[model samples]
Every structure is written in C-alpha cells, then in structure tokens.
Target: MEGKTVFVDGALPGESVLMQYSSVRGKFDEGYVKEVLSRSADRVKPPCEFFEICGGCSLQHMSSEAQIEFKQSILKEHFEHFGNVQPETWLEPLQLDTLGYRKKARLGIRFVTKKDSCLVGFREKRSNFLAEIESCAVLMPKVSELIVPLRNLIGSMDAKQSTPQIELAAGDDALAFVVRHMEPLSEQDKEKWLNFAEENDIHLYFQPKGPDTVHKVWPNDNNDRLHYQLPDFDVELAFHPMDFTQVNTSVNRAMVSLAIDLLELNGEERVLDLFCGLGNFTIPLAKKSKAVIGVEGVDSMVKRGYENAKRNNLENVDFYQADLQQDFSEKEWAKEGFDKILIDPPRSGALDVVQYLPKFGASRVVYVSCNPSTLARDAGVLKEQGYRLVKAGVMDMFPHTAHVESIAVFERNN
Candidate 1:
C-alpha cells in the first residue's frame, strides 16, 4: 500500500490511479480513478462533501443513469452468461426519487473519548470507526437532518455510555428513532428524547436489546399505524417496523403490479404466494384471483398475512407456514395446486421451491429478487423444469446505490 490518493470514489473501469487498500468489510481492496476509463458515459460528481469517506452511497459518485444502466446490464449479463436464455422483453426498470428517498436507515454511533464528544452517523469507508457527520444527503430529510441533533442530544444523555447505535425509520408521516442502549434511559434522557420529538415533529423508540423488545419511550398516536397504499385496488397494507417492507414504496407498487400482470389472473386462478411476508402481494392478488395461499417461513408474518387478508376483506387469501426449502413437497402440499405463482423470497432466491414446483403442477412463476446472480441460477433451474423466461426487469428500489431489485416471469411451455 502506497501513501497516495486513491480514486475509490466511482473510478471507471480501465483507469488507474494511486489508491490505498481499504481494510473495511464490503470495501474494495484497491481504488483507482478513471482517467482514460470507458464507463457507461453517465458519470457525475457525488453531491456529498464526505462522499469518499461515507460508506452509504458507493454509486452516488457515479451518475444515477449509470447506476440504473449498470443494474439493467447486470441482469442482462447474468441471463446471457448463466441462464443462456434471453428474455422476450426487458421490462423497463422502475426508477424513483433520487435523494431524501430512503425511508429506513441504521446509523453508527461512536463516543470519541479523547475528544470528550460523541459522533453519530454511518461509518467511514475502510474504517471501523464512525464517520463524524453533521448531516446526510441520501436519508430521508427528517432522519438526515437529525444526525447532528442526535449526537448532541445523546451526548447530553445520562445513559450515553451504554448506547451504541441509532436506527431511523420513517413510515408515511411517522418518524421513529430506535436507540440501541446497553443501559436504560434515565428520566432526563427520556425528557430530552421527548422534547426532541415534539419540537421536531418526530417519534422516538428505544431498543434495550433485540427488535422484539423495542417500544416507544413516550406513547404515540397509535391511530396511525405505519401503512402504505396499493393504488391499483385501493388496498392498504399496515406493517410494523420489524416487518419486511421495501424502503422504496413506489418501486414496491410497481413490482406488485408487474407480478400480478405477469401472472395474468382471470379471477378463477389458484395462486400460490411463496415466501410471502405480510401479504406484500398476496391480498392484492386475491382481489383479482379466485384464491391465494400465502406461505412463509416466519410464523409471525404468516399470522400477519392472515390478519392483513381479513382486514382487507379478502376472503380468498389464505396464509400458511412452511419451510419452502425442506417440507414444500410434504404429503399435505399435494392437496393444493397452483395455476399461477408469485415468489418474493430473500436474496437466496427461490431455487428450492422452483425445483419442487414441477410436482405440484404450476402454470407460471413470477420470481422477485434482490440479488441477480441467484435469480439467474434459479432461472436455469426453472428452465430445466420446462418454463420459459417471458419478461424480466429491474426496479431501482435503492437509487444512487448498487442494490438491485428485479422481477422475472416464467411461463410453462405449452
């Protein structure tokens, strides 16, 4: 490693420069600048002053257009290189707001004992230490602006010694700040958090340890649960902060629409929603189909799905709990068959379930993924099962970042 400036900040491919090795996790070992680099031609200067140090936005140093271009190309290359089957249509990537768009974030907090002060924000690139930040540009303005105040407020807290991090969550109009505290908040600390929320029109939550134990320091208006709307069918989805809701609500809606349209339900189709969480797409699909069975590995979420379906008056949707990777083909599974299917699993993709689909007799499978490589691998499996990749597309759920959310429709060959 040399003592030279490294262009680790969005250097194009083919350019070379002096960059130190970043030892941090999820960090590139070497960084370089793109002098004669031939990139996607949509490069731009990052808007943040701490662009190089902040670990939040790696692609922000690149242009937004290039980010989407790279995402689209990533899917394209995976299909060509791994799946070896081209999709009929590259459904345009669903793009959304660039800045102040993130609804959820987990920020780092460090007490600079030497300086006798506290620093609150994301960590720096290649460093375990926290980046002392005054504000963030990418997080929603409410949470972003709270960076400095949070530091000052926590610094004044009586229990600041036992605090490690703060999680920011904003749902619709409700703001929540869940503090990770090793020690309980004192009376003064609670007052400070209360005044901060009241003066700033924000809400504050605290976590003594795990997510299940998180509760509000002060009672909030429970009338407004964290909810988002499905505009297509005027359906509302109320989810807890711990629930798996996409931070980007706009792209989520587009994803649900695409999945439903691809399934092409005729109000008589039996749809199987696999790895479904809180009925993100199940209840809405229920409105258009004869019946839907939403299944998930987490029993709490399966219970939530049932509650959500009942709340929406969607009697056709039934939620079940099962481990798709293991017992998906148990003797009881044969009792239910699907004419169409929608799968929104985690980054592992739905390989295990796709392999089991052939036995149950499915007509179509709409796979939603946050990782493209796994999707391609599972696509290969579906292809072996006599399914054709009809259409595929990207959703810019996380703009100005490398996170890619994609969807593909697999239709059984006639």
Candidate 2:
C-alpha cells in the first residue's frame, strides 16, 4: 500500500498477484498478472477457453454473484462520489443468465497467411490483432457454434483477405450476421454464403462499404425481420441488423417491467420515452399509460418505432425524430405536458434532456443508463431540479464485462 499507483490487469482489489510491469508512465504504471500468488475466494475458473486471449470479457475470473456485487459497489461509489447524493432505497440487483447472454457483437476477422487460417472472434486483449478462438462462450449458443464454421467459410472464399469484420445480432427467434467485405464478393462466394445460411437457418447480410450499405442477401421472402417480444405487454419490436437493441432479452424484459413499475403509471397519465430506439420501452409503456410519446435522434429508428407501435396494434403512441442534445422547447410535442418520463440515453447520459424535466411537469422520471459515471453526473442535475431519488439499482445486462446498466427513479418533491 505504497503511494505509487499501479493498474494491474487480471487482478482484483485485495488480491496478491505477481504482475509484470507492462508500461511506466509519468502519473501511473501498468502491469499484467503473471501469476496469482494469492487468489480471492470469489475467483472462479473462466468458462470460455479463449478468455485469456480474447478481450470480449474482463471479469470472467470473478464469479457471477461477485461480479454483480462489484458492479453494484461501483454504482454506489459513483453516486456518492460524483453525484453527492444517495437513493433512499436500494433496489435488488436484477440478474439473469450470466453466460451466452450476448445477443449483439462485432467480431474482428483476420486471415493470417502464416497460420494459413482465418481467425474470427474478438480482438486479443489490449491488442488490435484478432484472437485465435475456436468458439466463444458468451455469444448465443446458436451464434457461438458458428465460429469454426464461419472461419472455414471465410477461409475458403477468394475475398477472405478483404473481409475485416462480422456484426452479429440475434433476436428471440432469429439470428442475423452482417459480413463486412472491402471488395466485391465473387459468384462462388455468394454461393457459399447462401449454402451456409440455408444450412444454418440464419439470415445473412453483406456490408460492402458502410453500415447504411448493408443489404440482406438471404431469405428473399422479405418476411424474416428480426424481432423480440414482450409477452407481458403483448408488444413486439422489429429492428434491423444494425439497430440498437439490448444485448440481453431476459434482462430487458425484466428491466422494462421494473421501469414501468417505478413510473407508477396509472392509465390516465401521459408519458415520454426519450432516446426511445425502436420503441422498446415506448410501446410497452403505451399499453399502461393513456398516451406515450417516443423521441429518437435517428430518423430511420423513429420511423421504425412508429411502425412497431402500429404492428402491436397500439394507437396511443407517437414517435418523433429530434436531436435530444439540442433544445426542443418550440417543438409541438414538447408542449404536451407529460405526467411521467422514461429516459434511456446513450453513454453520454441525458444532460440535455434532464434540463427540461422541470418544465415538462413530470411528477416521476425513470432514468435507465448504461454508463455509471454519466448517470451519476446526470443524477446531480436531476437533484438540482427538485427531484428526489427514490430508488436505484444495477441490472446485469452485461455480466462478464465492466459495462453497467442501471435504473434510477426520481419523484418530484411535493
């Protein structure tokens, strides 16, 4: 416990490890654990064979229960240190399956001529080179099983060297992959992809250039849109391969239920869902509230949100596209007073929108966040606006990694 600061990888607090200095900086030093002289009781054998090399997960060595506890501590530390406030009540930490929960990921692809093979998985830890992995334990079982086949599939193609990455998205009942290729695919390559898709019963899309250039190549029927359902509210949401959706469907369902409960929506109240991508929360809230307005920054997602609402046979929901970081006081939708609000902003948090909470006259606000630091910063702003933090808790949306998904409720002080 010297004054010198050392950031060690693969070592948790209170654990004695033999670490090799990796770098020496002016302010701090970096090291990697070479041997665990003493192990923590919470440490467990990592499930994935590639956990040592792959950078997909950091806390695989920590038990799932301990991981959740660590994350909860981090959330509490952030609130107290950054926000200068604490919740009156701490909600139970929400959790689900720890393994095979990742439904979305972008895997790096590399064709190593020296090995005369293709590598398909996450990048090596702390390096840009792709990790050599046969299979991934974190990906959905259906998608994880395809690692070896995918590597072989790409290795056999002439454009294998040109392919750089693969974006994976798995819904409740469907799986889609967007192959990013720098060069055009030959006819033979197309045939190989078609056979793979047919054999796997999965959809395939090709990204020749950018994300917008992605186009579906298989299942010409045009009916296989990726979707996830909320059986509780009878709401189904459809999204494109590149659309932003929660990686864990089970946790998402539970999260939505918790958020709605925190809102205390009474059917007669109007609600606002901000940063409402694909109307994941908007559609469900509409079922309980009299009317719900969903606002998104992306035009395509805003349109898709409205479509999702209509598909669910809900007419009490409306969606608008607007930059949430900018002022929307003059917008017609802003004039509609909302009794409750649900904000699910990106990692940057909802500073821009939180400023308008007082003016919206919402008695209750539910903030679902993915970044703890940003959430704490925004929480401070909410406190300044006469809202009292009623309850806050962490959601294990991402289990092994350091990502934190949290929900906090703030009620306007009477």
Candidate 3:
C-alpha cells in the first residue's frame, strides 16, 4: 500500500479482499472487492435473491445490528469532522422490522427481447440498466409479490415498450401503483390493468405524462384516500398518491413518539414545526401542545396539511407556506414566538431557517435529518447560537440501505 488512497466497494473495515481497480484518478483510485480472502464476522448472507445485482440495497450483506453500529459511527464522524461538536448524551437507536418495510418506491421497467421477458425491479448496481429480478424482498410483501405478475402483465400489453417505470405507495389501509406510460394505452391494455387490480385487491393509477397527469384508473368510486394513523396521538393523516411519506410506517410512528417525548410538552406550550409535510408531526404535536404552527415550502402540501388538521378536528394547528431557503422573516408566521421548535427539513439541512432560531425564543429544538453531514453543519450553527446538543440518535428508517435518519434535541444554554 503506497501513499495513494484506494476506495473499495463491497469491503468492510476488517476484511481482507482481492480488489480490482475500476477507475484511477489523479488524487485517488476506485476499486471493488473481486474476492474476499478473509471476511468479517459481521458479514452475513443477504436474504434477497437479487442482492448482488440490484442496486436497491447496499448493506444487506452486513448483519442488522452491525449496520446500526456502522451508521452510528458515520454520524459521529460527521459531527466531529463537519460540525466540530458532539452530543452530551447518545440516545438508544430506534429500530424495527427490517424486511418488507418499504412502503414506497419507483421501480424501473424494461422489456428484453433477447430473453423474451420483461425485467421489473431496481436498476443494476452501478449501471442504468434494469436488474433482472422476479421478485423483491425489501419492498412491502404486497408489492414485492407483484413483480413477476407485473412483468407478465406488461409483456402481454402492446404498450409494454412505452412503459418506463412504476411508482408504488402503500398506506396503512391501501396499496397504490402509478404506472408511467409514454403512450396512450389501448382499451384492451386498460382492461388488463383493471383486471390485475381487481384480482390483486390493489389500487391502480396511470401517469401518461408528468406527475400532474397521474390519475386513478381502477375503481370508478375513487373517493378513498391513502392514510396512516398514529394511535398514540389519535391522529390520522391522509396523503395524495404522489405525496412524500415515510417508507417505514413503524419507524415513523416510533420517531414521532420519540420527538414528542423529547419536547416534553405540558399542553401549555406553543410549538413551531418547519418543513412540515402534510402535518405528519404537526398534528401529533398539536395533541400535546397548546398550539402548533406548521410551515412548508409547497403551497399544495400546505393546503393538504390544513385539510389534514381539519380532518383530525385539531383546531389548534395552523399551516403557512414559505420558502425557508429565502428570507421570510417579514412573514407573520416568522414573527410569531414559540416555546419549542421542530424541523424535519430536506437533505440540504435547515441552515437558512436555523439562523432565525433566536427570534422564536424556543427553549427546545428537535431536528430530524435524513443526511448527517448537513445535520452536522446545521448543528454547528445552533451550537454557535448557544444551543447545546442534549441528546441524539439514529433511526432505522431505511434498514437495508446506507441512508441515515437521525434526530437530535438541542436545548438553549442558560
């Protein structure tokens, strides 16, 4: 090993492997484990048949417990290197069922004439081509089992070549699939999908163009909405098929409970929820707090959030639309004061909104993040503003993948 750095894929920290270089750059080189001479104790046989070829999951080769520890280490390293700080206390990691937990995904579709079959699943590892898979184990069982059937269904259709992808979304009570078709479907093809939905007891939707063109195709009485309930708070959230919702429902429920506990509301405090999508956390926070104000970037989502609040009969919760990345300090909602703040911003982190923390005079802030580097960066800003990271921990929202979902509690310094 010379002074040059080699980036290896499919290699663990304590494994000895025969690697083959894939790319060599001026500063660093990239390689993959061609053969493992010595494997780590944490290595395990992946459960999915398509693990090696499909790019859907990366850490399926490692044990579940080991995966959590590795993610914790990644969080710690990000804090030390990017934020220049650490939490006063580390909370226990929140974990749940690892398999069949994904409730949402976008799968690629390709008709391979050579094989005289259709491939319906994730893309190939490190490639744009669709992976050849009959079924998937990571997706919710209802959706996973449909992979082969879907392939056959598409193969029978004349517009099979026009189909590019399938978007899946499952709520507590409903399963929905949005088939993205490049061309208009013939009546025969439409009947095929309708029968498929009827036989499988699943909802079918069609997307002829952009996301705005998505419409329900099956069950002429399509008034039913997709929803998930938080039994702890007696809150039910209804969402559009294209709306953003957590893939793992159990972990989401646990995460909301943990956030509420960290807030320690006494039914007399005012809470601020930023980047609140469909009022997932806002409605629950409203159950314990005196009042909750939710802010989001999208006008449609904000409108839906208000509808969710009304549907839940939660009069104390209000929603407003604002671009958090830009200056919104002049807005009425931004001028309001609160006792607690909760932010579940996108992967870019909440640096723009975190800067205005002092104005709210909130004593406690709960930050939920999907990306650790950005979280660490925003944490540093809060630290500079006299907020100490009280406790932080990771959530296994995405069990088999490298994505990290974490939450942190920051209390203002006296």
Candidate 4:
C-alpha cells in the first residue's frame, strides 16, 4: 500500500496523492487524490452533481475541448492504423449542447422499502448500490423530470424486487416506458402502471423478454407512430422504441446536414444508403438527390421504411432488405448504379461494404459511424479500392459518456 498507486477518475495523469479505496475500480476504478497528485491541464469540475457516482458518463471531468481533442486523436489513430490512409481534409467535428441533451437512456431500477422509500436510479460507479440521484443533467429536461416519479412508481410495483431496468423513449407524439420486470407482475403492478400512465399521459411497455416481447398493457394500440423529422425534407419516418438512433436528436439533424453537404449532391444523382435504419440518411438524401435506395438487414424495418416513403410522397426512394455482409453486386443493384452513397452503419461500422463501395459507381461517398475502430478498418479498405478519404471528423453525440459519433467523406480518385 505504501508504493502502489491506484488510478483515480478525477486525478489526471501525472498527479500524486493519498487515497482510500471506495470500490474505486468499478464505478471509476480509482481514488480521489488527497493532493493534486499529477493532473492533466484539461481537468475540470464536472457539471453534474452525480458525475462520479453515476455509471452514465465517465469523461465529464475532462474539459469539453479536451474531450473533443482526445476523441479526434482516437479517430486519427484508428484510421492511420486500421485504414492505412489519412484524409485530404479533416472536417470540423460536430459539437452539441454538452448537458441535458440526451433523449434516450436505460435507468437502473431498485426498490428498498425498508428505508421507507423506493430508490430507482443509475448503478453506482463500481457498486450495485443506486446513485440516489434527484435528477440527471445529461438527459433531456422532460425525460429528466421522470426520475422522481420513476422512483415512486417502482415502489408501487407489486414485485418491486423484480424490477431491474427502465427503457425510456421520448417521441414526438407520445412518451413510452418499457419496464423490465424479472418476475411475474401482480395485478396491482399492472394497475399501478395503468394509473401512472393515465395520470402522467404516458404509455407503458412491459418487457418480459427482449424488445420483441415488449407489449402495451393499458392502451391496446400503444404505438403513437413516433418519427423524427428530417430538416426541410418534410419527411417523417416511423420507428419503434428499440430501433437504433442517434441519442442527441439535434446533433443527428446536424450530422445529416454535414453528410448531405459532403455528398455534393445534384438533382441528377442517385444515392445508396447502406445499413439504413428507417431511412435516417436515405430519406433526407432524397430531398436533394434524384432517388435513394436504402438497404437494411431487418425485413420489418425495410417494410416500414417503404411505407414511410409513401407517407411522405417520396416515390423515388427504394428500400431493400439485404444482409450487408453478402454480395450486393447483382442485377438489382447494378441497374441502379449510384452516383453518391451514404453509409451509416452501426458501431461495427461499414466493414464489408467498403469493398463494394467503389464498384457501386459512386463518385462521392459520405460515411457516418459511431465506432472509430471499425471506421478505421473500413477506411483502409476504401483507400485501397481507389477512394480517397476526403474529409472526416467526430460528433459528440453522447456527452459525459465516452461514446463517439463521427462522419467521413470519400471520393473516387479522378
């Protein structure tokens, strides 16, 4: 204990200080330095009261500018090592409101009636105990307000001990909550949720299993047809709560703008959106391009995408269901040779699609990804296939949390 140094969350590198263990490794994996120890100049006081204790965000203590600089390095190192090429121009990283902007989250739920109260919140940094938060600063204000009521609701559950998690989804038309109960709910539990929904004007989804098993209890038709609007496109896309979407809606809107700008679209150009989910980039691209084809792996999502296109009166858009890992070169894809392409794959990034990217006949391609490591790998493939990495940058989609979202542009070498 005399010489061993424990890594502390708030203590920046090069700091030294005395410390005691408070389950330090899990929540943040270190002790608060009694002295300055060694600290990075970028260190700053976290804005949230629950910063260190809550498991939600790990980098709030770092300066906002520092966060971006470090993230940019992660992206650069990834592309340099994995993709083996650098971009012609590094586009400016997108930044949004650093606090109270998160619209989606999964909250840890617990009920301990012995304290004459119910405790529902996020898990402590490295412990199973709740953070005992009054509110969360990272969540949208509307969503954040539910924290207290959420605590009370868990206390009312018949099997309060069985409540494990709460999935909060806020939509344009309605608010829905998915309660992950580990055991059978009593009739009283159902009624409590019913009364809560009625009073708060929210919908309840009970998830006995996975997202697929989530069901509406009070309203037979619980889905209020939620969709996030694209900028000036006048397009609305319907998506389920479980679907993958950028957490910060404002940043997503800006990301769509950057992706569209980098694509350099013309009215004559047709674009391909690979790994498109509910046509996030696809529909928006259609606003400027001649037509857009969106390919996704999920059949149901593809069907919903087509329907959404119809609802928006965008007849030029096409939605196809295809395993992105399989060959996309066929008569179906060849007939519609794309002039521009937008790839917004999941955290795995667009690894397999990079090989087919150049062959798609696109002169320009814009890629948006959440994971830098995978993006780096695919960037290498793109560079090898004769596409030059034109521009790239990161987006702070989820602040406080270390998750990074980024956009890159690739153009075929003339």
lDDT of 3 by residue, 1-414 (tens): 499999887888899999999889999998888899999999999999899899999889899999999999999999999999899999999999899999999999999988889989998887889988887888999888999999999999999899999988988988988899999999999999999999998888999999899999777786646899999999999998799999999999999999989998899999999999999999999899999999999998999999899999989999999999889999999998999999999999999888989889999999999999999999999999999999999999999899999999999999
The candidate 4 region of ten consecutive residues with least summed lDDT is 24-33
Report, for every candidate in turn, its global Cα lDDT versus the true structure: 0.79, 0.91, 0.92, 0.79
Q: Please report the TM-score between candidate 3 and the true structure.
A: 0.98
Best-to-worst ranking by lDDT: 3, 2, 4, 1
Best prediction by lDDT: 3
Off by over 4 Å in 1: 1-9, 14-18, 21-29, 32-40, 220-224, 331-334
Which regions of candidate 4 fall more than 4 Å away from where they truly are?
1-8, 13-35, 38-41, 113-117, 128-130, 218-223
* Model 3 global lDDT (CA atoms, 0 to 1): 0.92
In candidate 3, stretches whose alpha carbon ends up further than 4 angstroms from where it belongs are none
- Per-residue lDDT for 252-326 in model 1, tens only? 777788789888888899888888899989989999998888889999899888878878888888888888767
lDDT of 4 by residue, 1-414 (tens): 445546655555455656656553432445654556566778798888887678777888888888887788889988888878788898887887888887677888777768756776678876778888878888878668878887877776677888888887766566677889888888888888888887887777889887688877756674545677875567777777766666788887888888888889778898888888787888878778888889998998898788788878888898988888776667386456788888888777767788767667889888888899999899888888988888999998887677878888888998
C-alpha lDDT (0 to 100) for residue 24 of candidate 3: 90
Please give the clash total of every predicted structure, in order: 1, 0, 0, 10
